[model samples]
Each structure stands twice: as structure tokens, then as C-alpha cells.
Target: MFGKSLKVFGILLLCISFTGCAKARYAAPEPETRVVGGASRAEAFRFTPSGDQAWLSWEQKPTDEEYGSFILKIGRANFADGSPLPLDTAVGVEVVLWMPAMGHGSNPVALEKIDIGTYRVSEVFFTMPGDWEIRVRRTTEAYGVEETALAIRI
Candidate 1:
């Protein structure tokens, strides 16, 4: 009877020691902009569609109107090798915000060009947010179309 009780206590002590090694920790989210991209990216921006390129940086523009509405800027576009794109390179950009779970998108987004390789995007409305994706696309005659997506929660 003493031997059986001693073996049981030894097993219980071993189980308690293992449990302490597997403690879980809570992590707080970062406030910086993060984008999901493939290996073919320049700096923090993700450029896609392969070959000849364009890019969208993961920098958020501050908005004055409301919390749901925001602004974005598309700039510093370059080649896959990090070389500057030509000054006359014709480019068209479009921004879309959508919730994939609900299968719906927000209002129209305005794309305004300030200068060559520089653009000001506004009117990004989040409506109601659970999880949202901001799809930024750039189209050109040379490279066809290249796009990058940023997933965010509001």
C-alpha cells in the first residue's frame, strides 16, 4: 500500500511541473501598418502581377472627417530592383475597401493625382467593420495591372 501511494504522488508531481512549462501569454497588437506580401516586394510595399512593376506603401494617411472615413497615399513606386519608374510612366490607381465575411463593400473612393508618381486617395469609408481588406491596384499599358492588399480591423 505504501509503494502504490508513493508511485501515485511521483506521477502527480511530474504532471504539475510540465503544466508550468506550457503557460500561455497574451499579446497586444501593434498600431503600425502591416501588409501581407510575397517575396517580390520593394521595402515595406508589395508589388505584384510579376515582371515590370508598381508598388503601394503600407503607410496610413490621417483623416479629419470621422473614424470610419480615412485617406491613403500611393507614392514611391519603383521597379522590382528598387529603381525609379520613369517620369512619363502612365499609371492608373484604384482603392477598394470591403468586408469579405459580409460580402459587401463601402462607398466610392476618390483617386487624385498630385504629380508624377504621387497620388492622394480619399473617401475610404469603413461603414461597419469586423474585418476589412483594402485592395490597392495600379494599372498600366506596359505592365498590365499590379495590386497589393492590406487587411485591417476597425
Candidate 2:
């Protein structure tokens, strides 16, 4: 009985030792952005055939001018790779309706941020219905300012 109890105690000590030495598991870090051609895009655009809704995600950075400090580890969901963007980052979106053939642009449409990395612009109906272009301007400190124009025939 004494020998059996000693063996059990030793096994318990061995298990405890192993548990203490186990390493913690953490999520892998994200990858860095690579620029190709003249422009590097940290944003993604998705337009549906319904012609009523659009989704955009762009990277933004705000720096402290006096201190010259940047918020570190701020992550924006790479719409291209399906990652999560930081919550505190500021992003501004604008929508402009342009008639390329007519050489005129329409009134500004309001954009709302639905989540951390998604913006929704609704009720984008063209008045004349020809070759209408939607120019989306995304402004952020990280990427400065970038504009994308999408053409649709209604």
C-alpha cells in the first residue's frame, strides 16, 4: 500500500511539472503591406448587382503632430485577405456621382460606417442613366488619400 501511494504521488508531481513548463499559444501576427506598380491598396470594394448597396474598407492612420508618434499595432481588416481592422482608427468616406460622357458630377451622397472595416452607401440612383461613375474617396493618415472610380451602366 505504501509503495502504491508513493507511485501515485510521483505521477501527480510529474503531471504538474509538465503543465507548468507548457508554452502559451498566441495568434500569429499579420503580414506587412506590399506596394505594387505606383499604388498600394489597403482597401477592398464590393458592389452587388442590386445597385443599392456598396461595401468599402480602407486603412486610416492618425498621428500626433507635436509628439510625432503613431499608434502602433493598429490593424485594419485587409478586405483582400479578410482580416480585422482596428476599432479606434478614423476613416472618412465620400461618394460622388459623375457622368463621364456628360462631364458633370451630381450631388454628394452620405456614407455611414457600419462596422470597423465596412462602409455602406445606399440609394445611389443615377438621374440620366448612362455611363455613371461612382468616385469613392477614402482618406486616412496611413495611406494618405486615395480615390477609386467605379463605372456602372444603368
Candidate 3:
């Protein structure tokens, strides 16, 4: 009986140590930000049967004065309300397509100078019917970052 009790206690201590180690490994880190901005100017879009599209546009200001150039990073998520949902928790959330204007493009088609002020952007399209979220992350020349979120249903 004494030997059996000692073995059980040893097993319990090993399990507790392993649990602590696993918790440390599975911890999530916080996000890091360089320069902060007021809000991002983003637009959401959806297509009609005749190939027509809709857009929800907004205006934004630079986070810092050193912002010389800017590029928009767009991503899509599926939610009814435009709330920040975890990517892993959300269902049907996928990046349909993304376009980076200026230096934003991974494979830039062409470079064009955007007028420094409020401007109208091109219409984004949704291929099929579902909930979608469009997020835009703008990076400036001075390393300033700004982001905005928009939700859409098709």
C-alpha cells in the first residue's frame, strides 16, 4: 500500500509539471503597433447579377506627419455586424481577393501617384452570397499604420 501511494503521488506531480509547461507554450502574444492613426478610410463592395457593384466609402487622416506614401491592405471576413472576431473562431471567413495600390501590392501592376487628400477608390467585388468583412490596413512611408473594418452580406 505504501509503494502504490508513492507511485500515485509521483504521477500526479509529473502531470502538474506538464500542464504548466503546456500552458506557457500555448499563450498568445499581444499585437505590436508603431505609429497610431485616427481611423482608416475603407470601402466595402458587393456585386449584382448584371456585374454591378456597391461600395461603402469613408475618409481617413494620416497617423503621423511623416506619412509620405500609403498602401491599403484589404481582407475579408464573414459576420453580420462589423465586429472584431477571432479569425480561428469565425466560420466562412476567407480572403477572397486583395489589391494593394502604390507600394501596397505584393505584385504591383503599376505605380500611380494618389493626390494627397480625400479621394474615391475603385469598387470591390464579392463573387458569391455570404457574410463578409473587409478590413483595410494602411502603411505609410513613416511606418505609421492605420486600419478600418467593414462588414457586408451578399
1-154: candidate 3 lDDT, tens digit per residue? 9999999999999999988776465454322221223244433432212121222333322222221223332223235864222111111112212221221212111223233322233333433334434443344333344444344433
Best by TM-score: 1
lDDT of 1 at 124: 61
C-alpha lDDT of residue 34 in model 2: 23
Candidate with more favorable, higher TM-score: 2 or 3: 2
Write down the lDDT of every candidate, Cα atoms only.
0.57, 0.47, 0.34
* Stretches of candidate 1 exceeding 4 Å from the true structure: 1-43, 50-90
Report the poorest 10 consecutive residues by lDDT, candidate 2. 62-71
Reference-based TM-score of each model:
0.51, 0.43, 0.27
At residue 118, what lDDT does model 1 achieve? 56
List of clashing residue pairs for candidate 3? 77-133
Candidate number that wins on lDDT, 1 or 2 = 1
TM-score-based ranking, best first?
1, 2, 3
Cα lDDT of model 3 overall? 0.34
lDDT leader: 1
